[model samples]
Target: MNTYDPAALECLAAIVEEGGFERAAQRLNVTQSAVSQRLRALEAQVGSVLIVRSRPLRPTHAGQLLLKHTKQMRLLRADLERDLQDLAPRSPGGARDEERISIAINADSIATWALDALTPLARRNLPIEIITDDQDFTQEWLRSGQVLGCVTTLKQPLRGCRVLPLGAMEYVAVASPEFAKSQLPDGLSAHNFRDVTFICFNRKDDMQAEFVARRFGLKRVSLASIFVPSSEGQVRAVAAGWGVTVVPELMAAPLIAKGLLVDLAPGFKLQIQLYWHSWNLESEVLNALAEALTHAAGQSLVA
Candidate 1:
């Protein structure tokens, strides 16, 4: 196996993560010319084109493998930092941008328990970037090696990853009190559900259709939806009477308790079982993240 330069690998990660050669150079405290030279050198050494210089830069397959390799090295070094913190903290002299610990988590989890779970790590100045997507799609970030771990609905382990069940989060169909009373007066029955717009986290989110289908026993279900990319944004939209949404029970609970948001169907609970997938390495950073998420899930999610 040919050994690659660490600086070259950092250049690759910076370019992808920062989204441009200019930004990568700024992050690395290097000139744009230096960034291009390093990337070219790395590609020449590997004898492959690593990047596709498109509108938004993206890595080619060989580049993705190198990026994944870079991420694993970062993880190992992060673990080392954790271990050495008590003895001597590393100098914060150079570009720490590439040191970010990236994880893909469903937005619902981020709006709910994931942030609390990650508080300890964040407080200690761990560079963390959360990539949010639908629960079903978060695993793709891990599959592509863009993130070290992810919280997703996928149970089948990815190659070289370990899986941990984080319990099931119950999703409830909720809307503002006035909207429910005015529009869904019948409470999302088979006859009236079609009349209301369902607010979704994004196009990839199908929780609204899933909840309605399972609740009403329809093999095929479709919903008219407007997208709200953020979980908090979804809540705000529904609260402002934009539309009804299927969200985690915990997210809707406080509002439900406050009589701001009403649970449309009290009898039906849509539980999405969540799993933690991470690189199967004996590293403290990954282990801590897993433990924190698992513990928080046990308390908040249904067993």
Candidate 2:
């Protein structure tokens, strides 16, 4: 398009992220009709369809390109605002030079040791907002500009982003004592989980099954399972002897210490190496937060 319509590109991205024109309008504090008009104008300017209107909208490839560019623009704008505020000589406690740095992280990490890993930053008074979700999809939030940083399984960084390894998170197969005594076989093997039920965080969570399969050298977990979406509830169900589960070492540690759960295999473990992914921009806040995270990870995670 001859004219670079930042507002229109933003509206298009919101429509894709928020799932509807009306919702995007609400987010933009504008009328739904206005959002529609902006999309139509942009489509005419680009001479291509940007979206396919459905229950939850789907963006065309052209739309994704513009969305990526829009996100980069937003991140740059945030960095600029922070720099401008720094030049104003404003008070420290005020909003000057302070904008929320939204980050995506795994729920297990947030509820377990990761928060402690962030304690150093809190001690320094850094302002950050954490978004908890399945680690498998954490990178999506980065692409959508919903978060500037993420702890994700993807080793490589996303477009306009950089990645730094934060060290590995370990998980072990665990279950209630009663479940282990009753549901498990006399000598249980990973491939023999067909007889026992398993508790999973959600369909997207494959940690438990993957652990089993890897131990047995199988391609995948072929077992009966139950899905529990909540992080706390999943732990509770496993503790209640409803089924077996695989949980992070930090999450299972306290309960294991309290005798609420039993380790199926004392030494068997799965370690997922986490990385810090964020926009490759120079900002004092982001730089400070990154330093804090690196330092925290060094203390909390194994070398």
Candidate 3:
């Protein structure tokens, strides 16, 4: 096939990301009719359907393929512009304009040490946005342009993005002092609490149950598990002696120190390897933030 029309593909992708031709026009500072015409020309050039004309429009498979390439092109262009600027004479009021950046990260990091890594960026007053969700699904958002960066568990980079290992977040099995006294076995065996109730962050959370199974030599647990969504609530539930729960080292540290909860085992550990994934662009702001996160992770976790 002939080389794809870069300009037309960009316009089409912008339309998809902005949700409509009118919005895309606003972003590109052009007329809506011009955006529509460009899209039609793109479809003709590609010889396939590229979009679904539905509310909050969706990209067809071909559209998605083109959209991914267009975004990479955008990032490359931005980097080229930066390099060109560096070669030019400094403009008046010399600081670069603030660029908006969004990142997707897991909730535990939000509550614990992620903020510390983010502290320098906050001090610089960078226009940064954070989208918090389960680690397993955060990379899916990065695939679209919803976030330009993310902290993900996946070692591999998503399409059009690069990945850098952040570090491992450790988790420990814990329970309230009172609850442990009543529910745990005298010898703490694998089959000790075949019927003990436990607290779980959500269906996506298998931390506590996994610890139990590993400690007991079972593939899975059939015991009663309670679902609690909030990080604070899960820890509080364990503190209240409601049940046992496995919590991140950062989350369980203070409570364990205060004697609100006790470690189920002193040596058991769970570490999730994290990565900082972002568009492979040359924006100074994005690069600075990446450095800040890496520095923070180094200090906080076993990178």
Q: What would the TM-scores of all predictions be?
A: 0.95, 0.82, 0.70
Superposition TM-score, candidate 1 onto the true structure? 0.95
Q: lDDT of each structure?
A: 0.91, 0.76, 0.75
The per-residue C-alpha lDDT of model 2 at residue 280 equals 85
lDDT of 1: 0.91
Arrange candidates by lDDT, descending. 1, 2, 3
Best by lDDT: 1
Worst 10 residues of 1 by lDDT: 89-98
| lDDT of each residue in 1-303, candidate 2, tens digit only | 386688898788778767898888998889999999999999999889989877667887787777666755665655565567556644544431124456888887776666776776555444556887888888988876666788888998898888888888888888888888877645358546788888888778888778888777888667678998776788999988788888788778888899998888777788888888888877666676677676777776655
The model with the greatest TM-score is 1
1-303 in candidate 1: lDDT tens per residue?
Answer: 999999999999999988999999998899999999999999999999999999799999999999999999989888888888889865544327667789999999999989999988787767788998999999988988889999999999999999999999999999998999999887888878889999988888888999999999998888888998999999999999999999999999999999999989997889999999999989989999999889988888887
lDDT of 3 by residue, 66-113 (tens): 776665555454455455665763353433211235579887888788
| Residue 162 lDDT (model 3) | 84
